[model samples]
Target: MIMDANTIKDELKKVGISINDIYDLVNTKESYPLAIPVLLDLLQKGIEDVKIKEGIIRALAVKEAIGKASPILIEEYHKIAKDKMMLRWAIGNTIYVTITENDVDSILQIVQDDENGMSRQMFVLALGKVKSEKAEDILIKLLDDEELTPHALEALGRLKSKKAKSKIEILTKHPKSLIKKEAEKALKKIG
Candidate 1:
């Protein structure tokens, strides 16, 4: 079912959370397109374990719920993104957006997880999104990673960084056909 503001309101009310914390979220004014408004509608409320978990969960869902985000909404999105499952998904989505410098460590760890292959895709996608000069080394490191090389190469090419050129120069010579193909394509594009 499509969740409406009423459901969010009800959930917040369950834990005695007043919309005061998120008055802006509920404001119905301005052009906030974020899934959940930038308010601690659930987090700042007084509640115990159950509520805390529920609050985090509800807060987490906002990332999926939103279709667009204002700067305030994006800030709120990243703050709640500290939640694990939610953060994972958010990084996957926001990897390309202009991220705050502080968010780099955690998101980079997502790229490094090796265990979660999907995260490599997310990390690559996010790097392509950010297109930051800082991500060049990590993108190049993806070249050496036996496990994550494919996605990393793809991200590197998509990023098309001048720094990425050296790595692509090397990857184009790699033994794997798929990797070589992608590297060649990236080289052609960036050339």
Candidate 2:
């Protein structure tokens, strides 16, 4: 049964149902689209609860509702500090899911401005998803970065840029087995 927004809100008010329980229900039923407005409202309320905000972000990501929630997520991203890695990761990933041609420059700027490896990785992954030649070029430059190589390689593969084929072939012999395996996989994908 499809639960309407009002019913979902009413259910949340019940004594026994927790936010987590609601999250599970939403996930199991694949009903996150229905909950987008509610989640956005909760996020906007400044609930001051890290766990709740995290859950809201996760739900948005699962539902692929990032386009609708981008403004709020971007606001939350600015409000968050680099030290809060997990929350930053969640927010970054959500921003990533909504990436578009318009967001490419800003995303690159965020990657350059942020020193956090994890945050940079998420942004690079997002760049890969953009499937633009510019994004492909950026990922190629990042291939030599120890912290970003795996993600960059994965993104390049996702783009299937024939130009990246040679570089990926070189990585096939990398000392790290994981990198080598990923490179080989990316090579196959590019082919």
Candidate 3:
């Protein structure tokens, strides 16, 4: 089943993947090459990982694979998150991927939904990875969403957006001490 680069390319051509795809899979900033095959195989089988380590390697590769991934591949991953255990996937995926600014924006928008708090939280933490102006409004909006406050504050702290100062300050007065603490931390960073 092993072959040279050309053989691998020919075999993959029949499946619609290519050598450049391999480059993206293995060349991410994170060491994800080790997981690429497992993740791709899992996706092809349309199965979800029940444990973190069960597919941890693959998850890491999938994460980095998104860094320069084609939009179609990104969408495919998004679909996988939606159709499966999204929270778990996000938590697992974040460790290995360095997705683009667009992926961060897409996640922020999706987390706006009330039922997607896990995604919201994951997206918040992920802002630490791909900080951008697109995340500014979304992070600020979390101030009004009681459930997202903590994660939002974390995102704001990491994102360091100038506009976040006003929104972050308001959280310092939140009834929940935990949120207030997070807000205080975010405001400190904003300054």
**Every candidate's lDDT:** 0.53, 0.72, 0.57
User: Residue 156 error for model 3, in Å?
Assistant: 0.9
| lDDT tens digits, residue span 1-191, model 1 | 32344555565566555454333343334333333432234333323333333343334333333333223323443444333444444435543453444545555765666654543465465565455666667877777775667767666667676777887888878999888888888787677
Candidate 2 lDDT by residue in tens digits, 91-181: 7787767676677776776666537667677878888778677778878888888777888888888888798888889999999988898
Per-residue error for 63 in candidate 2, Å, reads 4.1
Residue 163 CA displacement from its true place in model 2, Å? 2.1
Ranked by lDDT, the better of candidates 2 and 3 is 2
Task: Please rank every candidate by lDDT, starting with the best.
Answer: 2, 3, 1
lDDT, candidate 2, at 105: 73
Model 2 has how many clashing residue pairs?
Answer: 0
What TM-score, over all chains together, does every model reach?
0.52, 0.79, 0.64
Candidate 1, residue 50: lDDT: 38
lDDT of 1 at 131: 52
Off by over 4 Å in 3: 1-34, 52-58, 61-97
Model 1: lDDT of residue 26 = 31
